[model samples]
Target: MSRTLPALRVTALAACLLTGAVLTHPALAATRAAAPSPAQQKLDRLADQFYVARAKFDPLLYATANGDSRYDDQIGMAISPVVRAKQFAQYHDQLRQLHMIARAQLPEKARLNYDILEFEINSQLDLEHFPEHLLPLNHFENVPSVLANYASGTGSQPLTTPAQYRAYLSRLNQLPAWIDQAIVNMKEGIRVGVVQPKAIVMKMLPQFQQLRSSTPEASIFYTPIKNLPAQFSAKDKEELTAAYRQAVERIGPALDSLCQFLESDYMAAARASSGYGDLPNGAAWYKARIKNNTNLALTPQQVHELGLKEVARIQRQLAELGPKLGYTGPANQLPQWVAAQDKFKPFHTEQEVLDAYRKIYATVDAKLPNYFSLLPKARLDIQLEPELTRATASDHYTPVAADGSHPGVFWAVVNDPAKYSNVGMTSLLLHEGVPGHHLHAALLKELPLPDFRKFYTEHPSAAAYTEGWALYCETLGREFGFYDDPAPYYGHLNDELLRAVRLVVDTGMHAMGWSREKAVAYAMQVLGYSEARATNQIERYMVWPGQALAYKVGALKILELRAKAQKALGPKFSYPKFHAVVMGDGTLPLPILEAQVDKWIASQK
Candidate 1:
């Protein structure tokens, strides 16, 4: 998952107010003159305070990807015991303040804000019981891997100005200390019997090896110095380059040290079990992830059953398409056969793969206005992922800065293009680019809210909100006329079916104690996934737990809301307005999103 992209803030489309005779009516004029209620006034002040407090405490929250320069110099010690204690204190204080608010007395919008804040505070407090910092480094997401990417000059941390370069250099110098602390935390995790699976620990080895370059100039950290802005004075450029090279040299030992610790100390202690079910409080931890990721109260068993039914349903559909694709095999074998077809893998070179996706973007962009009344002002950029991580990386989207300073990127992993297919590229563009993450994220900044609402990039416990919207956008291809062809349309189904499989397989391994092999086999049988793909997907679920389930859960909720709105409005239903309601607010929990849709439905009548 490309979780690094900052949400873009586009210019809000102007809405014409209800004008003419209504404005002049004496009764309406008198109503408009009334002041806000006392509870509403207090709620407004609290909201402002809450937003400011978050920004002040967690500077890295916004500065990480949004190109917010305010916190550029501060490399927050997110794992430090002192920092954790302070954060917990803040959470407790905020919760106390939140409890004092008269939530019932406030307006609906303010009440929703209160609910979101209350949920966020309590969840943060709940999470404190687990020592997450102890088991921080994973193959999927960790500080070292992320820092390596940021240093490569292509990631969210911008290095355009000399000051920006210097700021990052300060952050760069913290690498050795950070690595030392991580080793200590890992040692603690091993002592507490909370280590990562050996399978994932081995995956981290290659990443550490990648970061340990022989020289400074050869390192990814030298990227900014190499591409220094032409406007810099010769003396300043020389000094900055030297400083950056020195920083990279210092970081090399840290990378090597961490790598050595993992190989020598951590690897032997790492557990063999793949699921969270084996650890102490592992079940409760997994459940917390389920709640946070889906933002719903569903039990793991319920989600598991839902996934099983969805997989069966999608498999039945695949059987229907099997004969159409000239396959007469049993339904169980159909996925393997479809995956082996030569027609799907047409691109021979990386450029060919890039060109195919570019064409898809062009086609989708042309027809977007037909379905959406509001579109992002920012355009999308298609790029290939960095070569080091490309093989294992998923095709993902990274949002441009909200100020439109940077363009939103749809990064496709292009290693071994022969194994990859163009069949799903169009659908991929729809989900990652147009109506999916790019459009959804880009429009967040244009909303009428405080900086916290637009720029608070940390609350992704609402994964369902973000991933679900993108997944839902995948279905729009059919309505927009891009997936009329069977191949592309099936691509859409394949993606959807994969998400459905995640709900089953994620809960299966973590909650039901299914072996990794069993889960992989099920995916290959049902989703037409190759062994490598299936294994990778299952392993992703193994390490991340419930994160993958967010897509299907969220998309289903959004789809349900759309269906309900359509039924309520009948022929009068406006798809554009419905979308506006969904994207109008920044990312939200499904229940709040449903309430928003219901409110819109009522207003329509």
Candidate 2:
């Protein structure tokens, strides 16, 4: 996800107030009558320390994305043993300090912040037992792939200023060393029997090859130099361009080296098995992933069983809806029938595809106020995915800049517009644009929460709540009047079925010993995905085990909470208030969110 925040300038006195430090300044002492409790002060100090330390020691992008520019000139070694040790030490120390705080003494808002910070700290500490750094690069998310986007001048990394350009060049100069470290970590993974599946390794090879260009000018890393602002002087442009070209030239060999290593040494060591269960301590690792992604104590078998029931439930609906759309096919064949329909593939150009999404946005915007009192200040913009990453990337949402400098972007992957089905367009817009990710994410940033909470959605701990809320938003299409047509309604069901299918197939492969081919075949049968598409989705699950499960698991919890609220409040129930409560405090863990919802329900009574 792309992350950028508005600049928050904190003066020394303001910083003291933020961290709950004692105010002895006469100007402030005269105005203040009561001081915060000691426990509250301790909690605030610990939270502030952890937040700043994370920005410094964690990935540089985490800081840069949040408008913290302290690490802009350095690409820190996130996967190195030394860095990992330091990160673990920091988390342990912070946890110790947090334990000393008296949670009962804090007010409701401070307690909420404490709970979130505690969850974040514990989540980091959980990784200390695992060797995640050893298996770092994946087809879905890797350093080189992300850095290429930063260099392309279109991603979260800013290239508007000369200093930004210089910082990027510094990062490019560091590329070789980072690639060398990844190789070292992968070698360790091989020794420890924690290698990626061969299928995933094969996917990474092509990505590295894509990053290598014949010359600096043709490289993605040269993009910023080419697009240098007109305000830059001739001398500034010349020096920066020369520096960028040299940096890009240096990066080519590094990419080629890594690509060659993966092709040869790494490929030979790659595991034939697809699931995490096949690795050393694989089952336990998969369990950790499930807990991290879903924030639930559900076992793999339970999740798998739940998925089976959900799939059956959604399939029954599809079977019933098929006849209305003039399809008399069996339930399993519904997706294929829908795919074959000419009416679904209406767009012939990218602009036509974009316009369709915009039209849906307009339709949803008019009806939003009826159901949502809490709306994002940031406007949503729809754009086609960039060519460099479009092939591997799905349509997704990028967060809005906190300062509203840039609108939230819904990137539609329209590689071949003629082949892009219009069936799911309305549901997709709702999920990724208006009331889905864009609304949830932008509103979180705008909340009067700690900086850590404002930026918390990027972490794995918040995945369930954020993704669940987005999936739930798709169901809102019915209330918004976008699903009156049978086609659009089918789209909603199709999307829901895909999430349900993920729960089953993800657990089946990682926990039940299902092969990659078996999982792909299951998706193709149920979701009517092409062989290539099914393989892509399955491989994604293989690389990021249990992540796909978040959508279904999270959505079901929200839906259940809403049902409880409706039953209890009856006539007093309000969609606007319920939505506001769900979204008002930014992203939260599932249990905390449920507790918040229950509290709101009681308040109405």
Candidate 3:
């Protein structure tokens, strides 16, 4: 089998054809056939070059993640200047041309290629425009913080060999510069009005200071060194032990410095202001970010309004379930019932957490045939988020490749499995696993589109279509005879409520001038999230503002579109055909998706 696009970043390459003057000459057309245009020939050659490029490329994302020699010499560091510049220019150049082709009536393959290319281009451009660097190190994904966990040698990177251990040492040593640059960039954001809210920065102090711990053994990053590889020569192990200590000395001090600066300087300097739009050039920056992310011309107010409608609709459902779950007496009692449910209580152990996720997958799968025309070829598994990452992460999906070599993963943060509630598992499973990302992405990767088209771009249609569809799935519990248990069905709506709350809270943070505290408070009280989980989600929105908006906004639009398609086609609509069309040619812009569906509907007649 051919290699798949490695990490699935949006990407594209274009082939343009030109017209010859002779082709435009009436006399030539009347008397003789036209000769080939050089531009047309060059464009064809460019297309061929693109194909060759695709064949040769398997993006080294895999090697980077594993710390393979493919980049063993390269330091596995983040926040570098050179890396960001090339990323910006390469994507900028590709998109400028790709957009040119998109405006043309090109062949279906060419349009698909350009569409995918546009997505890749946008992903790169998103960084430069957003003040992401301002709050570069969230408690969750900041590289310096994560390295301490990776240094523990329990993460994805291989630390088995003595040389591999040293390579990690080298990566650890590079942290001071990375953090220095990150601080510098963030300051730039400050001057320009790009800044993270002080609320998140306050939460960050404990995380970084935790790494500044007095003993290397006490540091989270020092765990790997605490245990040496048994196979290493004693002398080599001794040297590695020294090296690991030295690296941590370097990293530990940096973390401590970060802690000191964060406690004394950074948080003070951070804006009490919440939105990026509060910064200089803020509105334009926010607009560009929204457009790039949602792939539509949408205002914050528009999205804010969208969030409200979804919240109300979901609240109505929650009211209906409150009685079944012992929220008897009144509709208002539902929130009280939701808050008090023992079933909504988190797992007390990791096994319980995994078992809960497993139950969700099994229960859903048992009823899968009623909803899906496609399913992933690979199995799904649940695991604890790596200790290195769990502190910073919630839940996430890692999709399998086209070859079905990797199983789709539903990684829950099992460190605090007691914080893992069963109430949200069903809807969360739908979003991350079957009929959500895995099914949509795996099938798209397997489709007959061009290499770039298949893997690069995630069409607005897919996320809005698939996620919204899954959110809709949570509502379909009774239809499948699953949510009749009341608990699981409540779990399904709890998941749906989370997405709906994302709508309100995301908009509240970025658009309505809601403080981070206000966002979390609303989430805790109204959305029924625990203080710890609410803190994680709220901080995530602060670090990356508009992204949270996409989930509910996209999902709601898809549900609306599906209703439209169902109405237009009536009995003629085939669920299988509807799905095939949605998944067939890779991701699509929502407008194009609607058009594609409209065309498909016409074709049926």
User: Superposing all C-alpha atoms, what RMSD in Å does each candidate have to the true structure?
Assistant: 5.1, 5.8, 8.7
Give the least accurate 10-residue stretch of model 3, judged by summed lDDT: 14-23
Measured with C-alpha atoms, the lDDT of residue 249 in candidate 2 is 86
Q: Could you arrange the candidates by TM-score from highest to lowest?
A: 2, 1, 3
lDDT of 2: 0.82
Model 3: how far is 468 from its true place, Å? 4.5
Tens-digit per-residue lDDT, 1-605, candidate 1: 11111222234323111111011113322333137578777766766766555554544554555435566566666677677788788779877877887888876556767776777666567677777778778887777676677775566666777777887888788777878888888998899899988988888888888877778888887778878889998988999988888888888888888999899899999988888888789999888888878888789999999988988887777778767767788977866776788888997888889888888888887766655655667788888998767756788877677655467788898778787776788778888888898887676655445455566333556678888989999999978876667777777878888999999889888888888888888888788787888887787888788889899999999999989988898887766656767876667777778877887788778
Each model's backbone clash number = 1, 0, 7
1-605, model 2: which lDDT tens digit per residue? 11112222223232222212111223432343247788888888888888877776654545555434556677778789998898899899899888888888887778888988998898777668888888978998887787787775555566787887888888889988999999999999988998999999998899889988988899988889879999998999999999989988888888888998899989999988889999888898889899999998789999999999999999999999999889986778989989988878988899999888888898888777777655666678898887877878878887766654446778898889889998899889988888899888777666566777776665677789988999999999988777789999999999999999999999999999999999999999999999988898899999888889899999999999989988998877777767767876778899989888888877779
TM-score attained by model 1: 0.91
Candidate 2 or 1, higher TM-score: 2
lDDT of 3 by residue, 140-244 (tens): 556665556456443434567777677677767777776777767766766766666787787777777666767866766567677777778989978877876
TM-score of each: 0.91, 0.92, 0.78
The regions of model 1 sitting more than 4 angstroms off are 1-63, 66-69, 104-108, 456-458
Ordered from best to worst lDDT, the candidate numbers read 2, 1, 3
Error of 1 at 165 (Å): 1.3
Most TM-score-accurate candidate = 2
lDDT for model 1 comes to: 0.75
Which model, 1 or 2, shows the larger lDDT?
2
